[model samples]
Target: MVYPREELYPREVFDPRDVVDPREELDPRGMVDPPKVVDPCNAVDPRGAFDPRSVVDQPKVVDWYNAVDPREGVGSRDVVDPREVFDPRDVVDPREELDPHGKMKVVIGRLQVVFSRAMLFTLGLVFAHSLVDAAVLSILITHLTAEWNEYSLWKAAIVVNVQEGTLAVAHIVFILLSDVWTGPYKMLLCSAAISALGLSLFQVENVVSFYGPLVLVTLSQAGIVVTLRPFFDDQVMSAAGQSTAETQHWTSIVWWKCITLLAAASAAFGLSRINPFGTRSLVSAIIMGSALFWFLLGTKFYSFDEATGSPLRDAAHVMYIAAVTKRNVEYPRTPNQLFQNSSGHVKIPPHVSWLRCLDKAAVVMPQDQEKPGHICTVEQVLGAKSLLKMLPIWMTFLTFSTVSATGSTFFLEEAASIDEDFNFLTFIFWQRLSSFVVTFACGWALEELGRKMKVEQRMILVRMGMGMGCCVACCVAAWINARHWRLVDSMTVSRLVPQYVLLGVMEGLSIEGLDNFFITQVPELTVRYGPAFEECVLGIGKFLTAICIYILTLLWRWFGEDVYSSRLDKYYLMLVVLSSLNLIIYCLVACWYGDWRFPIPAEDDDIETANHNPVDEAVQEILLQHEKDSLPLLEQKAGQDTQTLRSRSFTRPSSPMVAHRRFYSMRS
Candidate 1:
């Protein structure tokens, strides 16, 4: 409901006379004198006293006594009599406070402005969605063995390992086919439907029915990650206008993740107590259903990026063109020497010098006279170059992915072998929540440091460092595992908190680093592709982990046959060495790394002035073209009064369209 000015300030309701009188007194001209005074309360008609709907709600109440007269002689009581004042809180409607514009606004104290109702609803759904995901990750295999007696622990490990491999494949397939998905709404609906069907079919008493649904479950989980996550990232980036908003954006994501983990942890614990009904999966299905409903309800309010066809197609085309245009060519003297035009041009970006061979794609050949853009635009070539550049950095994250998969798979298995005397509460408290606590605590400090440094790339580097630290911590935890193989009887799951906490920190920093880096660096046309590419990277990592596990499983003689008789600590020690080596490689890559052309805050002119790269110069040329092309077409002729359109054509191609046109132009 609309708030009324009078209701907000019942004492001094809006008065035309008061407004006029104050201005007249404050006016230095002194052109008028106070004629008379009329009590507005008595003069108002009973039927037309105040139309509350017509008034705007003022956030700040005006104290007329102090505000009306700036002169020191005017005391607090001079302009507004003490008797006329009333408590605004008494008359104000709290509903108006929540929604002044008659639209729902979700507020958690100060965060109301940034976190809209729809966003909060979406985040809630995310939390519930993650409950299902994490529970699957943390509890599914263990549940299969412990409660259902489907298989032995070692066999269960194999089943779980296979499931992760399946999950990675599912993610890769979804990403490749993401172009067909349309938008997040459809994906959410699809995920919910698949999850419901899978969970329902999971109850059936047959191996075919059970494992088949598990595959569907894996697909559904992929849907959630590929769809929901990008949508949220879009929202956060859209809303992050100021530094506070940026911090809040990351903070909200971390908080959502924490809440999701906590919910998942709770669901995992609840699995034991909920009896024969399979309530954990049931609740998960229910949450998925609820999330779908919420997503559908909020669809209208949700924002989507301008769909720029499939990134897969773009990448493929670039590769095809680069391959077709291959030549034993020398580098051009200058970038502009290759493709020079009024509207567009190609550039051999210096940053991409590591792969000088790819630069051949942008090399204009005499064959171009026969087929103009059959090769590709300079930008398209650069886009392809970007993908090549990303591969090395992507591989560095493989070790991290391996570490993460091990933590969830091996650690959960370790928890199962621990003392049965410890209640679920103890395990949940120690194993589940400690990571969140450390991440939440450390995430704030790290983010604050990033803000102080004012370099987002530095934060990315720091985040990777944290990931390396997690590797170290994992190594230590593994050493402890080697030393104390069966401490579960006394200390129980609580002793594993160190490893969990470290992994949690690792996830908070490294995974988020990957996400933020991509979002910030990737061009708008390929922005949607960033998340999918990330999924692909992590998928490869998971696949690598699966391979390692399978190899380890095959060589049971080396790593030991099972958890009880296993020298798992030695395996952990191996990972420690691998991680250390990986860190050294990553550091070297990081040292050699040059950042993509990132958008800087308008205030920071130093980066632009200090060191300009070839890509930046190319982008600047396009921006200048944009400025030139966008000149106003309608203007009054020099001596004529009437407006007339300019002679210039207004059909200039957009950035992506231009690139596409350039590609085909060469073919023609």
Candidate 2:
């Protein structure tokens, strides 16, 4: 099928970079007129059997032979089209030329890399926090201080639970950072520094003075995570970080697993007499150093699309809000002419729906082709009041955050129980080995797990699994401290090992899907309320757990010390009951979540919403009107640099429809 030179590579007005020699791309028609768009990710065959149009577009490469629709057999209900999920514009079949399996090899390797790098950084924080709690929990549970282990499991749960709010608290603070205009890197650095300091003190202290430092560390961590959504791909949403585009929930699961596996290995196979507390402190130091290094260096690649905070972008949104309320003074200052021309950034009028504006040459702005004032306004309700329209979202957010925080705190003690003999590297080694095997199993069996389940139902099952693990943790502790529990005759090392691993598995399930659920329900409140909401739920759980423990203690008191020592399993069984209640509540909440309804496009709701950008209009207005009053603070913040430095802006994509349409596509 040789063609004239004109047909193979034509000279045209289209940018050469966009051009792909049809011979190289999937030019199925040697006889067809002008060449077509290319697919980069999928490398399908060039023969007439495939349409190639629906495939992704990308840099042209020559070669052909491969099945493109391999996913058809695997995809059932709710299965997402990876093409649309990754990007709509880049729909070329990257697997067209290469063998089908070859691309998968590359894709898997890429996934491992992407997954690992992100997982390591996030899990490091979880490990850091859990290490501290493990030391505290271990010491208290073992009654090592000559002081009575008077606290009930609920009280222990509360102390640890309060800090779980850190994840959400970080988010709330990050929204404020949007107003203050701080970046994710800075937020993360601060979080790490504070966490390290807190852990260091824990290494040299008793429980009486632990709360102050712990609170500081929790605040910093929550602010960083909440504001800076940890997912790397969606890091570049806005300069002020008002509108979130990416979610960092997956990191929670990955970290939870890492922490649990590490802790379990330490507990099951650690030195017979090593101090879990000291080892945790040492590990915390190492993680802090790594955090500082990444926050400084790796941050260049990060952007604030909810994964990080971007202040300038928030300023632009403020301008949008001001115009809506007819306040001209609050508009984003028009870039000074000198910088404007140099930066190639002209102010767009406020009424413009960014989704409907696409600036081709520029990296940002991809809604419509219109410029500035030409963009049109969307008439749908899109403010705080609108959020109330869907009352169930907040309810679910609260319910899930509460349970997730409880479950994660339950894991904290489990993670801190690493083998005394394992050094940091060895601990990490065992963690990697266990994680690799377990993660593979989960991936391989996810389809089967989801077969008869909705996302909500599956998640409840996950929570119950975690609850069972907590029961396992209590039983394991009782077995290890059997003499005190009056079970010295039956206590054995082997009995504890399985319990440790069981808890790890449970942590994997409970921690992994939590953030994904929260982000799904309340994306709009992310900037101002994301962390606040998360922290509030976590705090409530922790506080309640503390109260429950007190109640448990009173109940145990009535029965006498002999009763507690002889019937420790009773306490273990009680945890099972409590977790069961939470798991049931989660499933019920799932029933009420009608994701199918939303004025915002489906794509906008994604964990990586390519274009879901909604500013907190109420919050933005308050900040703008008060900016004059806060001028001193702004001045200290270096004069509010909402200006762009280069010919670039990290904008949020706005196709919520596309995101939602296929959200339930990848169903079992």
Candidate 3:
């Protein structure tokens, strides 16, 4: 429970000029009078201090002491004096010994703490952006199909699918830029500005202008979403200083996201109902502009990761090197024979056999020695292999994403047609709320279970599997609801609740699982691309949904201009079958994944070790000193009360200080 002082307050918070040292603040003689100073050489040997003869006739320190002492009673060993345990060399002053490099490391660590705390501002930005984003997207389809536009349902669906697809592609482009060139903060500012501009353009009446603005909005939103989470994560990890458990840090991220989702849902419910859709767009623009302003206010405190050169480029180099060397070079017989740097700056994992051919990329050829760029490091090759290993698991989630696309499109259409008085916004509100609750609960439960069971690595797969199973259930519920709506004339929007709730639950589970897996499993240098890859996968799923709808319409009358004539129940039935198959495939992939653990980079371990609290070392020194000072007093009294000590019971002290203090008081 006693945390180090550095953990509570970073070193940057204290300045020598601002702090008044007690030694300099007051006269030493006035504070502790000269008369009160004890001279050890001239002092009396107060009874039972060190002289064994003084306590020859006194009772021993405690009765029954011999019962626990190994030398006195139970299996006898050499009688080792407690005083011998205190070694002067063992009690080091951590501050006094630290070199210039160590001092700089301490300063950097404190600065990292200051930067990490700035994630509070990042969370506020997430809430603001997500609020406006959800409000705009929730009403977009309805706005297109309004009386003024008179747009066909198919036309609206195409616009929505196109926006979704654009978002997917934008995620990749923006994330690459953030990682390789611009950095996240600059990317965030640019995206926010573009989003505001796009939202403002929605006021234009020309139909031809719609698609252009929609693409702008989708691209900007993708950049914001892809950049912000990773930015927040960087701060959290730095703030943790590699000292806290990884599960706890991720749990905090999940909980913060749930809060952002809840806020966005509330904003959507309230702001999407602003009568005219143009007014809603204008309101979203104002909110986004305000968020951008608020984000800039924290610019000084925010931590920005320096843009590393592209992982894709490194991957390409690895492949090119492997191909060029294929005919002439042979794979190294041992991993150490490969081209690792003498300095060991990069921590490469043991060579994996999955992509054995790529090992040639790392072979130290005669020419490669002179041109280091011609050969790839083993780390780069393994990073590419890790991505390939994750491919099958990523493919399994496409069906889940396809099923999710229905909530905003077909599900809303179904609700709108059921009853003229039904509040579809309220349905969306409840659905968002359900997902937020499930996400919060699942994150907490999984963290606790993983900590207790020591199975933190496997929990990500379990969460993904649960979400996939829920996707199938969601589709089944949709089919049932659609069938009941067709058979009965009095059905209300309430009939769609089950499917909506299941959709929310599925999202809460699967999305977090995918995010955690990607972030943790990928090489540290390329982690920014993880979430972007997830968004790209979901976008592909939306395209697949569009493709399925197109094929179905071509073969039979599955969809029409409105919800009433469309055989949506059949479409839902098809999703149920596809999702069921996806779930089975996911299980096989999970089994194949087995016990492979992501290797934490060696630098992180060094940081964790170096970040230990110096205050803890100082405290330990004081405790050891106390033990040393008290031992002779106890030894002097031990022989006098040997009979009395045998009859009295003594419980072990909770701490070394307690034991030392108890005997010191006895000597007094």
TM-score top scorer: 3
Pick the winner on TM-score between candidates 1 and 3.
3
Q: Clash pairs of candidate 3? A: 60-641, 63-645, 64-645
- Per-candidate clash tally: 7, 77, 3
Instruction: Report the C-alpha lDDT of model 3 over 95-118, residue by residue, as the tens digit.
Output: 433422121112232221222336
Which runs in model 2 stand beyond 4 Å of their true positions? Answer: 1-106, 109-158, 161-171, 174-181, 203-212, 223-283, 290-489, 496-502, 519-536, 555-568, 578-587, 594-668
TM-score of each model, paired residue for residue = 0.68, 0.47, 0.69
Instruction: Report each candidate's C-alpha RMSD, comma-separated, in the order given.
Output: 16.7, 20.1, 23.9
Once fitted onto the true fold, the runs of candidate 3 whose alpha carbons sit more than 4 angstroms away are 1-120, 147-150, 234-255, 323-337, 341-354, 600-668
lDDT of 1 by residue, 441-503 (tens): 665566567667665466667677777778778777856865586554344566676777677
> What TM-score number comes out for model 2?
0.47
Question: Please, what is the whole-model Cα lDDT of each candidate in the order they appear?
Answer: 0.56, 0.38, 0.64
Which regions in candidate 1 have their CA more than 4 angstroms from the true location?
1-113, 147-154, 233-255, 258-262, 268-272, 299-301, 305-308, 327-330, 340-347, 366-373, 421-441, 451-456, 486-491, 559-561, 594-668
Q: How far is 95's C-alpha from truth in model 2 (Å)?
A: 20
lDDT of 2 at 505: 50
